[model samples]
Target: MAASRNLPIGFEASVAGGIPILRVIHESTAGDRLRAVHGILNGTANYILTQMESRAIEFDQALQEAQAAGYAEADPSLDIDGFDARDKLCILARMAFGGRLKVSDIPTYGIRQVRAIDIHSAHRLDSTIRLVGSAEQTEAGLEVSVRPWLVGCRSMLAKVEGVNNAVFLLGDKIGMQMFYGRGAGGDATGAAVVSDLIEIARDLAAGQLSAKKVSGFLDSHDVGICPKPRPVSWYLRLTVKDQRGIVARVAEVIAHRDINIDSLEQEPHLPKERLSFVITVEPVSEPIIQRAVGAINAFEFMLEPVLLLRVE
Candidate 1:
């Protein structure tokens, strides 16, 4: 039936049961033109990050707690690896921009490397971290990514804690609109199903039993994905086996890229064998920072890969 109707037929169909579905495809109406859509779509990732921030726990500890709370699966690869959020972002981007999108097309960065020291640095800056999936339409084209973002303490994204989810939509006419609630769990899912059923029942009573096709899905144009670099403040956490000359080596790389370091901090009382260096750089384009990070990661002293986070 979906094939005949030329519907958006993929993930939802596999698990939606027999219920009639209605989705708010942003591009379907002419009343508003979408500018951007950003969301925290994975409950497990959110739960883990929340625990790490509020409880001052490590990534593995938070993951264990999330598993015990039934928020995370035994494997949890999709959630931890950011693929789940990437898939959700693709659907949202397709709806907002009216084009075909694949999960592989979007750049994805997971939260597995986030450490307690990174969380402490964010706390010092009056901010918190969350995995954000975002799609924005620019003059060049659509820019999309799924990664950890440093959200300010006063921002709406930071207020979204625990297993709750939030989606922020920016439109031409509406400006900014936020939708927040429980993004998972049986109770929330059941409520959503019942809401859809009630709306369908009402439409049926009105003698309008037709399915509304998603205009964006129906459109055939391919979404142009342009990788435009935007200037942003960054949080970099590097764990090294030795601290000697490590800062100078990393600083040289950043200077070579013409990026200025706003501040550099190293937490005290850490073992000399395993030290953490937190660096905050002035607003610079992502490509510049990526280049510097690439150079820094190449150093033999690095115990693990450097963690790069976008500062809100």
Candidate 2:
């Protein structure tokens, strides 16, 4: 096709390994642009989270076990640090808007910070952990982020978990549509790559194409990060090697912040030397609850910082 006039495009495989995804492109008519993308590029972290849930092991221990099991790479930073997700998002965003994006420009958070206490607390609130990578039109360019978000059970977004990936497309006329499927494994991702290659080859064979839909991303919009987000309940877990005055100390911090505790429980099975103090606060702004958690975590009796979770 190159011998003749051709403009074949589309990258091979996921920018990262094992994320079953692709970007299909074509000449756009006078209509809103469309794109197809896949996510969840790493199976190591997904498998670790899954096994941890079943084994009821701590995050650190589970990660170590995963490394031993050869599921995780020697340096698993990219997978766990949300960098891989960012790459996938960039591909999706470029296809959606039609421009280039710097991966470093996007903010990302990994599940490494998530704790077993977080899992338990989410369970208490009937929610779960999900890695969400999103790019949405904002007054400023496109607001984008990849991080673990607390999602309610009833929300369709919450249904994506483990190694599965999903994508969402919005258009003036098309509205909203979401695509979901297994997001990891070589075979699945390879198939996606080929799909895009095939389309690009066909388009190249057809003739030169216009840039309207292809270049939408080049139009820069400010990237807005949601601040003062909606109110939601929260969980705070304080870890300490068993000691007296722990409760009183923890209570004082909670009270100072004017945070109302809807429920409080001392985690069962925690040794006296290492106790887990769990508390749930009523619905409030994320910043406020995080402030209280920060204050309480500063207490000397705290073995590790307070683990915070958004409760649905």
Candidate 3:
């Protein structure tokens, strides 16, 4: 209706709070083609992950702290489970890539399973964990997902902490640009809302209250998913009951798939009945690793399903 009537719609507060990211992608990049857009889109999830990294706390403890601090809701499934980020990613990807994206189509994984032990392991590897939403154009199609990534300590993504959010835009003319600020809060969101209102009012005064055609959002064509995502390093955390052949059995599954194990370390002092094994594997696609994980999960000694994190 708005489009038909040339009525302007304001939605800047819906995504990254006060960052004005939607405007930047919708207007500022008009002259350039965006190659990719990715970042830490959820402040609640980021707060939890940063707390886990800085205080060395478990996911539950960090989550409780976030809730107490008012950064997360009592039921934080939307934020912590990657769905919140997924919706936001859909908006950004459509704006940047010019396509119709189903919010449910994007694969999402949360930080609920992340543990203090995982944080400890990340530090050993000089890295930290972050929930990242990424959408990039590829020859096959658009490759997009929202998941926890094991980012290096020195990487820019790892530097975004607390309730802060950061977005990176890659374009042919702009190269790479980053927008950083408080992600979600009354102050940030209110400011964004006001800015949108001000812009709408100005346009009304100028007698130019016309709907801007955002290609991706307006286009009826569906975005395509990549057929085969490129291979990358992976981290697999397995909890198992310590048995005589546990290591060998797990190794055989990986070996059978022709995937190379980069490194394997078992946390010391864990009870024999419940042990945590961290395995880093060489670059491999998702399907291959899932196949290996499935075989390993079926073993009788396994206590829990494998927790997989992509090593960035």
Best by TM-score: 3
Which is the leading candidate under lDDT?
3
- What's the CA error at residue 94 for candidate 2, in Å? 6.1
lDDT of 2: 0.59
lDDT sort, best first: 3, 1, 2
For residues 1-312, could you state the per-residue lDDT of candidate 2 as single tens digits?
Answer: 211212223233334332222333222212555423324444556656655555667888987876776556678786677776676676566556555566687767777877776677666666666666666654435656676665666666666555555565665655665656554434454343223422332343354433322333444653344455455777677788877787887777778877788888887876788888778788886678778777877777788776665553
lDDT of 3 by residue, 1-312 (tens): 434422225543443335556667776446788889998888889998988888887888888888888878889998899987787777778778876888789989988888888999989999999999999888889989999999999999999988877788898899999877766643455443223323433443465743243434666688998867778899999999898989998999999999999999999989999999999999988889989999999999988888899888
What lDDT would each prediction earn against the true structure? 0.76, 0.59, 0.80
Q: How close is candidate 1 to the true structure, as a TM-score?
A: 0.85
Provide the lDDT at 65 for model 3: 86
Q: What are the clashing pairs of model 2?
A: 97-216, 97-217, 98-217, 140-221, 140-222, 141-221, 141-222, 241-273, 242-273
lDDT per residue (tens digit) for residues 138-173 in model 1: 888888899999999999999988777677788888
Number of the candidate with higher TM-score, 1 or 3: 3
Scored by Cα lDDT, where does model 3 land?
Answer: 0.80
